[model samples]
Target: MSRELDLKSEKSIEDLKKLSKEELIIKILELEKLRINKNELVNEGKKIKRVFDFTKCQKRHVAFKLLYLGWDYQGFAKQDDTEKTIEHELFHALTKCCLIESRQTSNYHRCGRTDKGVSSFSQVISLTVRSNGNNSKELNYCKMLNRLLPKDIRVIAWSPVIDNFSARFDCTSRTYKYWFPRGNLDIDIMNNAVQHVVGTHDFRNLCKMDVANGVTNFTRRIISANVKLCSNNDQFSKSRGYDMCELTIVGQAFLWHQIRCIVAVLVLIGQHKENECVITNLLNIDNCPRKPQYSLASDLPLNLFYCQFENVNWIIDNESVTEVISTLQHNWASHMIKTTMLGEMLKNIEDLVPDSINKQSDCLLQGVKSKIYQPLMKRPASESLENRIKHYTKKGRLKIENNEKN
Candidate 1:
């Protein structure tokens, strides 16, 4: 059936492709209204209500849970300035696949926002949908969407959910894991240190606070925390070098940069570089208002393990989300294997040295002397120690006491 035209002779019907996004939306609504009337009259066999824009302002919507590896991406949530976020890709599919209206609508809600370079195994999101029967299959929502999205992003599972099944508020808990170089990490010691993070505590100084969100509260509870060493995964003579260490964490919620801070402290204890007393001091509630002195570990090694769901009843269509799950798995597997290979190659530098003529340990340390001080000392090799001290004092950067023998 052709759409009725209201164009003047001056306007060409052939130029519809050049319409602006706003104009195109108006055009789509016009076309959809016509199609629904036609599709329903044939079946109203009169039971189906031929309502125009049934999904618009309607409570009916489909929800989805997705997964992604965030190593090469910016973050889970999208921003106006960046193109690599998970939310950006999600909205692209939503709008392009006709899943929702403009990106500003309340049609979408994700479980949590993982930071840049972080990944998720089971990230949840909810959205509204149009349906025929108590939410029938005629909606064709999942098939239509999977066909349009790229390989890296996938919709692993989805189903009709109650209007109140908010992905953010209704979540039970989240699990995260951190990987480390395995060799020197004392697994037992690290496991013991993790116990300190459990229970309610004020961790204001440990987490990186996002001041923009009005988030002055820096306290969180740890439902469970532990460290484990993977068996049968150790690097051998020919294996890749990345199998050095591993640690996992589970919590109800985490503060911004909280995982990294915890990892830094955990690794310190794992290496036995810091005593348990210092770790306890850091976790003390009275330590409040005291300045933070600990440094955070790197972000590349942390991942969002999984998001937990409750008895709200999820309808996961394995066939619908299979492609999405597989694509992400393949991408992560390939990247990890290659990354491990490169690490192994670097580890072979020790083999290049001769057994008989080993360099002194301080050989590397000597080169680390301050470049500024080296140049000044080189220029006055014969000068007295007292004179060198006097020279730097005159310039006013260093303070030193000279004890000289005549």
Candidate 2:
């Protein structure tokens, strides 16, 4: 299989010059043909392995925990005319692994549907799959799923569940964490501002009201909300320019764009543009009956941190765990190096600029902060949910006063 040329290429230029031009041309052509032949042979030897044949066994309900980076995905749920979704890829892998014949027959249920550009560390799903049968050794679900899934999506753990288990309704609570750079905004003010989010409240003004989609209930219970810095006191350190902070929210359920909307209001308060009374005003449906227009916080930093369930013990495959860890470490190292390189370039560019023309030195907060410091109430408003529902209803695009079911 060795393609070691009969004519050596490492010979000196003097040796090559000794040959006539026609001889050199022929030698070059011969070497190119040999290289192409070697590549074709190598490719011929690398055919895809045959997929595993599923066993004839009983079907069982199971739950699996997964993690994914969502920057390249449209969202966590499948949609028409789009192939770039987490659920779409998951179903594809499940089919490839012969775990489920099809999603329609699997009785599938997801814990929550994350929006585009939002990631998950412990997203869970429950589904029925062909199993190794009762009293038999269980299959390595994590390993089998990961083998067919994309590198960015990995199943870390799985558990056997009762026949009636559903990942969506059986879950008691869900937690989300939003990360952001610690910019020049006032953290204490934001922390104080966000305390209003706890407990049961009518959040019609705090979330994207989907009345047209029949989401008429605006009340939801928040278990807790906390905001904290990742480090003790590194604000003065130049090397640690982009110190991170997170706001974690635990709730029974959340509406569409709820967390992002909350974060946007908190950012407004932190910037001293909006008063803390704005939150109270929004929560009191009597005062602010409809949601005012405001930009949502960026989605890339939001993550579904944990999904809570009861009476289920997860089975971990050690080999799959190791592979998942290695994959994450490789991704982390690559991004870290790129960030460092970009920082160096920015520093060099700033240094080369004259003092008179140079703008302020920067951190990683280029698009994180609001461009204009306007009070939330003073900004131009977009159409409210009530207005949208009326407009659509008048055009016969929606049913009048329809309600969301489950």
Candidate 3:
């Protein structure tokens, strides 16, 4: 290149170097333009290369272990015309990382679809993803995904699985945890009532029937139901009023709003508005043919705690683990500091104001309190599953009649 440039020049290299400053400025501009033009030509030629070729890489079926605080999402699964979902953010990250071309081609399966405002500590999903043929220089799945996903959502671990694994069907049991604040309620009665929920039984009375979606089966087996106090510390000393208590329910599968409905009944039992017999009555479907209408417990504190699958070994990336831990620690510290400041402000207000003036029930901690205690039996009956089916049948028949007349 230097020889060619010297051959084309009017002066030898030594003479050109000794040119005046003005002459040097003109030459430098000419050279820079030439360099830029060459770069543009090279970039234009490179555009012909393919962005990605799926055929060049091998695929592996894997399960991603994830956790998220779902206060801001609609649910775990994707929905039509909505971007506020855990699956939406997950797919965006997966596509950005070139893990899967799109969700349609990924062969994805989620263990459970949690409701809006629900959270998860160990949600799992299995999908086929692009992989290095020999597992050498594999992509860091956890760190790569977490960096692209929202801070509320994190991928904790991943496991390569056999070709035929499905996250939803292969799971033996799923555990859900519901955290609540203990108010003026009886824990012993609530525990006794929860005992009846164990074993296989028809739980139509305890769930919102999705008969409209073609769900006819209401029977679900409960592995266990346990209630325990999580902390003795004064939750209200921090301005939140009740101490933390948790209810863990393990089952093979669940109905829509099943766990939340169960918590509603347990709350009534604890408040002495409903007896332990209410559970048995609800279970005896022949006697209590219809469910009574009652408000479902709040969804914010419910979490998909853990999922147990069959013999799949999980692989952990060490660097991703460190990153996830550090991120969580930083978030926790920020929230803790804010909460402490709020507590101090509340204490000062209480010191100035009379107790009578600030006697609002700690409704935020515990659920909304009933002005009058109504027994479950005395409450208005909710439409039974059979009634819902009948209503839909009639509606369909009416539509057919209208069409025929027209």
Pick by lDDT: which candidate is best? 3
- Which digits, one per residue and each the tens of the lDDT, describe model 2 over residues 1-406? 1344433554556698899999999999999999999999899779757755545557889999999999889999999989999999999999887889889989999998998988999999999987877534788899999998999999999999998999888989999998876665667788888889899998887877777765767788889987777653232334333557789999988888899889888876766778888998889877667677777778888899999999989999899999999999999999979977876776676566564221211221225546566666665656666778778778777764433221
Give the C-alpha miss distance for residue 323 in model 1, angstroms: 2.3
The deviation in Å at residue 226 for candidate 1 is 0.7
lDDT of 2 at 404: 20
Pairs of residues at least 3 apart in sequence or in different chains that clash in candidate 3:
236-241
Candidate 3, 1-406: lDDT as tens digits: 9988877774676777889999999998999999999999999998875588887878999999999999889998889978999999999999988899988999998988998889999999999998886666766789889889998899989988988899888989999999876765566788889999999999889988777666767888999998877876453563333456789999988888899889988877877778899999998999898998788888888999999998878778888777778888998999879877875766677677555232221342244557876788878887777777788777763221210000
Q: Which residues of candidate 1, in runs, are more than 4 Å off? A: 1-59, 132-142, 234-244, 336-350, 353-406
lDDT of 1 by residue, 1-406 (tens): 1343444422565577678889989988999999999988877775854445635444465567666668778888888788989888887877765557665665677777888877776787876754556454545565666776666556666767777777776777888887665555566888888888888776655566443334545567778888875643444443322344566777767788887777766665655656645556656646434434444576676777677877655566667767665776787799879967865765476567554222211111112333342221123223332344456567774433221100
C-alpha lDDT of all candidate models, in order:
0.63, 0.81, 0.82
- Identify the runs in model 3 with alpha carbons over 4 angstroms from their true place: 1-50, 234-241, 346-370, 394-406
How far in Å is the alpha carbon of 292 misplaced in model 3? 0.6
Error of 3 at 108 (Å): 0.9
TM-score of 3: 0.80
Please report the candidate that would top TM-score against the real structure.
3
Candidate 2 TM-score to native: 0.78
Weakest lDDT window of 10 consecutive positions for candidate 2: 357-366
